[model samples]
Target: MIERLLGTPYERRLLGGGRFSGPTAWLIAIMMFVMLSVAAAGLALAGSARLVSEGVARRHMAQITDGRSTGAAAVAALRAAPGVVSVTPVPEAELRRTLERWLGPSARDPDAALPIPVLIDVELAPGAAVQPVAAALKRAVPQAELISNSGRLGPMLRAVNSLAWLSAAIVALVALATASAVVLATRSALAAHRATIEVMHGIGATDEQITRLFQRKIAVDALAGGLAGALAAGIALLLISAGSLASAGEWTGGRLLGTLDLTLLALLPFIGAALATVVARRTILHSLRASL
Candidate 1:
């Protein structure tokens, strides 16, 4: 049944080629380029957004130990500090285990390491002033130094947000270009098949039938293009992931990399097919009406 449908004279007429031709190849190439470009841009935006959010979430000190005073006293001072929401005292053994989990077996050797500092996990009030709070902590706890989470995270968040905006702009441009390309391609295909369409009409073919034929052809072409484009984009992302993993090495702890979710990746082909079908059908119908 599939072979009969694909091999029919009507299918050839709809496709504007003999299964393989210059116009068909060109249309496929253009659609693939557009789809891949859009996909890449979307992935970039998602990665940037994730990086920014994670940076914000992790903007706090992880460990603080007091060598001059008892660990319990240090925890008390931190808890009483203004703008601090809560402070949880983590034991030395727990701290060592956490470090070992992130830094590997070498970090677990207690003899070679300095006495692990008592970790006080601080939760600050929302909209609290960070610099003033850090200054107050420094004065209150002589053995404690302010760990500047913002120093590492602030610049990274800014960079990621900027990149996200740039990627969004690129995606918009790609979408506009794709729409224009589809419109022009459909117009050309309609012009080339003008005589065939007129003959079909003369022989009593309905407008709906002709519209369906063109829509089917456009959908098939788009599906092929979308598959090719999505494959290319996935390979590109994999290469990027591999490079990042290689570069991160031992420092890969607590780092989150953004990736395209399966759902978004799966939706691309269907979106492409729908867009192509709607655009092709609209263009053909409008042209037919003009001819009438």
Candidate 2:
């Protein structure tokens, strides 16, 4: 539509291709920037929640206080149990290394030699009942303790759910505010150009033509504002990532923003433009009809 309006003389006259009033462009830019930030935050938090959920859902662990031999027994029993997918006995030395990675240089301190329990990781088949599987393991290895993190999963799932709702609300509010901004701009332009529009009406120009001019103009302004907003959002995200670099690995499991995630976020500018165009056209149509 913008390309089609390039050679339209009257549309050009109406648009003027100059800066809109002071607050209009800034209003859009600020709104879009906040929207982008909220969107990115929601996405990142949701990703973290998903990681926690998947980590908990896909696996369970059994701790053996007796020794490796007892842990091995638990592993064998888990393998033979129905709905058991696979079991891996975690070596004490490997556990020590993992602790070391987390604790860093402090792990080498003499006080760091605290006893770590032997661990056996268990995976269940799809749609399997955890209680039955856990009971079977306990029966097979009477000394083994079944660790169920009902509390952990519950909180993570709830947080994910809450984030989803919050993100939706933020998106809805941003869209409403953006549409309102476009409508206000259209009304202002129409009020300022009433005489010109009336003359155009007398000369046989349809309301749709005038609406297109406003749509194209608003869309272009929104595109510019959206791009500015996106850039600001990008900078903020980068700064945050930089600040959290030391803990990013431990926090997000080393996979924070995948390519697909960033790709979706990058579409905000175009979406803003389209939204602005729709709002402007609708406002123009309604106003024109009311006047007629």
Candidate 3:
């Protein structure tokens, strides 16, 4: 049924290829490029956010203004606390170096008499409640200021999520635009071949035959354009990934494309072509039904 509907090699070309083919191919290519780029960005953003969120959820920080004894006691309490994984007290020298790197030479000067506090990093087991652990830490050292990463990361996570959603929206709009272009192109082809189509109908050509003639031509054009666009988008993405890898100097697991990302990207061209073919077939068939 499918083969018959699409016609065969012996079927004469009723909708002849014309000037629209080249421009239509180029237009689809551009749309595919934009769609793939936006989709890749959205995937990267979503992956990064999940990684960061997990890391933040499992970790908490404490700045202890009290003496070394208080810091040691706080670490002990956290290590023994429910849902606690591990605790590490950052060395004072390391803390001073970090401050100096960020705040300048003044932070390194012994004469400046900066009161560098004791910092303890606590890692909680998965599914731990931050508030309970924070309360336990406070009981151990009242002077210690407990900080939950979730609070600091909230706005940043929200922003990243918003951008990911925006990327999705852009991809959807590009798809809609591609479909619209295919529809208009199909309509133009139908208009251009109206007289020949009417004469075929007069000679006993059924509507299905006429529809198949247009569908086959439209499918070929769509397939050609889709493959071309996919190839161009693939090249652009490769160059982008190469530049990103060069700048990063090392592959951090989340920064590069994963298996799923590569698969989706690989399918972009076929998906675009399929979309164009489907849109064109529907538009042409509908127009034929109304006219004849």
Candidate 4:
């Protein structure tokens, strides 16, 4: 059905690609670009949120200032715990380095250099309660404090999830704008060519033939716009991925956030094109029915 509609030449000469499309293609392209960007953001946000929400991804720090079973003993005890997954004690020097990397020039002062916490990172199995890990750490080292600082992370995840929702809403608005443009253009074309269409009908042309003719141009215009938008978005995402990767340079195991694959945004063009085509066809069919 689609092939036949696209193949129709009479509609091509009638709509001629130039009469109706003009700057309308540019409008769709711009709308598609913004839509696809939002779509990419929404997809990445959802994936990151799911990763952070996982129970197995939970991490805690055993900040030991002074403890009996400190360092190796604490790591071994935590390793043997039922719910615990892994225990790696961070070296003081490495901790200072990480702080310096984040703090920059402020961390260079010898007198102002603060004492880094003796941090032992604890990983838990999926769905495991933090209570068991904390209990095991306290039992092993009386002075080892369980620093489950997921308190601040909860708000961040909520914020990402909210941003995802906002992105999705923006995509919806863009889609509406594209559809509206197609509908309005189709109507204007129909109004301009009404007499020619009626004359064709008087000869023998069915309403379907006339409708399909106009639809071919609408589909072509939509596809052109969609392609432009898709290419722009694909280039932008590729550039961004080259700059930042999710697994690279992560300090916290629990708070893994950068982006999931934004390649899904590439499909937005086809989606937008299909949406525009459908809206145009429906509007044309309705207009034909009303004219009769």
Candidate 5:
């Protein structure tokens, strides 16, 4: 089926001409860039969300273990505290490394070190009152500062949620822009080849055949554009992530980094391609019918 499609005169012309057409090529290039931008933004947003969520959790856990001297004691107290499900103390060395990674080498030096606070990890009961627990921990631990993970986390989560929505909106806008570009480009291509289309129709070419020719041509163009965009976006995202990792030393002291799922990254290209193809096909079909 692929061989036959490729063998067709329309397909051959489209493959050759579409590649050479400066405007059409540019449109594809722009689409690719936009797709990549959206992907990068989405990844960043995800990273931020994870960082904020983890930070909040750690802070809250610290609140639970506030003022406790021994790790064992902190854990035990946290366990006994109302709304606490479990508690674990993060090692001081590990915490130092985490801080170093985020603050950089200069920030990690001895002179730069502040009296580091101890961090305790806590899990809350399913329906626990977070505020009450935080207040209780504040009272129980005089030297130990109580950090309500939710209090710190709520704003970050909201920001991330907003960013996610914004990314979605941007993606939708890009899709619409790509579709419009394809429609206009296809219309122009059809117009330029009007004589050819007329001759084909006059000689008994059916609408289906005409549609298929245009569809096949546009689909290939869209695919190229989508793949290019996805690749560009992926590369840009990697660069951003690398830079971020260097600066932040793994978000949320590495917990957030752990949550950066590869599966989500892998799904991006397929989604871009599918969306591009559908939009291209629809735009071409609609434009062609209107022209006819």
Candidate 6:
């Protein structure tokens, strides 16, 4: 297919003599860059969702509002309960440290320390019903409030998923824009060289040949732009990854790009180039048919 799309020497001499070089290449580059960057962002959002889902699966939190004695009883009850894997009580000092992040150093001062709820982290066995566990825990310790991790983050997860979908929509819009630009450019080039096209037709140059000529030029430009854009996108993503890595312990989730993600991003430029080539060929052929 690539060989057939290559511009013949005769074809170039016959119809490729335009004064304006056009901005197809640069246009394609900008489109590719935007598309790739948006795609990477979508991938990152998806990865975060997956990590959070995995991290929270079958996890539950029990908050005892009564006292430490109630927290101890809840932990003991959870440990002896069926389908419960383990239970750990959050230390008061650790709780104070977490509060310090929001309430400042005053949270750590004993005199000014706020009332802290006793939190027990619970890990349930697979397929355990949260309702049954909550009911049992409620009966065991009335002051305990059982909260499912997934339920707590459900809204946030949905929001992340929505943003990921929006990113995909943006990428699709950019691709459609790229194709539209190619179509307009091809038509303008055809219009600019109408006399040459007529002469080529008179001299036995078929529409297929002329179409291939335009395809070759547009394909080269698109490919060059796509590559440049892809390079820029890659550097940008690398910088983002570097920044994320520099934060080290801040992001306890997974990496931005997995192996599959890397492979797909790597192919984006080639895919964009091929799409532009196809659009250009179709536009040129349709215009030629209309004109002659």
Query: Top TM-score: which candidate number?
Result: 3
Which portions of model 6 show Cα errors greater than 4 Å? 1-5, 12-22, 82-85, 96-116, 125-136, 245-252
lDDT at residue 210 of model 3 (Cα atoms): 77
For model 1, residues 1-292, the per-residue Cα lDDT tens digits are 8644354675665555543243433455455555555555555545555654544443456345535255565666666767777776666677677888777876678766555765566667766666665665666665566565556766766776677567667656665666676777778877878888888899999888787777666666666766766666667667776766445432433333343345665676667657767877888788788889
* Per-residue lDDT of candidate 5, residues 1-292 (tens digit): 8646444764566435744343654676676677567755665666667666755564455632223254455555667778887677776667668887777766456566355567887777656766665555555564555566677568768888788778878877876786677667767777777787788789998777777776666666665665666677667767776766556645444432333445655555556556556665676567657767
Give the range of the ten consecutive residues with the poorest summed lDDT in model 1: 249-258
C-alpha root-mean-square deviation, each candidate: 8.0, 5.4, 3.3, 4.8, 7.1, 3.6
Tens-digit lDDT track for model 4 on 98-141? Answer: 78888875565556647555688888877888787778777887
TM-score of each: 0.64, 0.74, 0.84, 0.76, 0.66, 0.82
lDDT of 1: 0.63
Better of 2 and 4 by TM-score: 4
**Compared with the true structure, what per-residue lDDT tens digits does model 6 show for residues 125-200?**
8787677778778888997898878888899999998999999999999999999999888788788888888888
Query: Where is the poorest 10-residue window by lDDT in model 5?
Result: 63-72
Off by over 4 Å in 3: 1-7, 18-21, 101-104, 243-260
Candidate order, TM-score descending: 3, 6, 4, 2, 5, 1
Give me the displacement of residue 257 in model 4, in angstroms.
12
Error of 4 at 285 (Å): 2.1
Please tell me which model should have the higher lDDT, number 4 or number 6. 6
TM-score of 5: 0.66
| lDDT assessment of candidate 2 | 0.76
* TM-score of candidate 4 on Cα atoms, chains taken together: 0.76
**How does residue 93 of candidate 5 score in lDDT?**
66
TM-score of 3: 0.84
The list of candidate 4 runs beyond 4 A from truth reads: 1-5, 18-21, 52-56, 64-73, 90-118, 125-129, 142-144, 246-264
Look at candidate 1 and tell me the lDDT of residue 240: 72
Q: Cα lDDT of model 4 overall?
A: 0.74
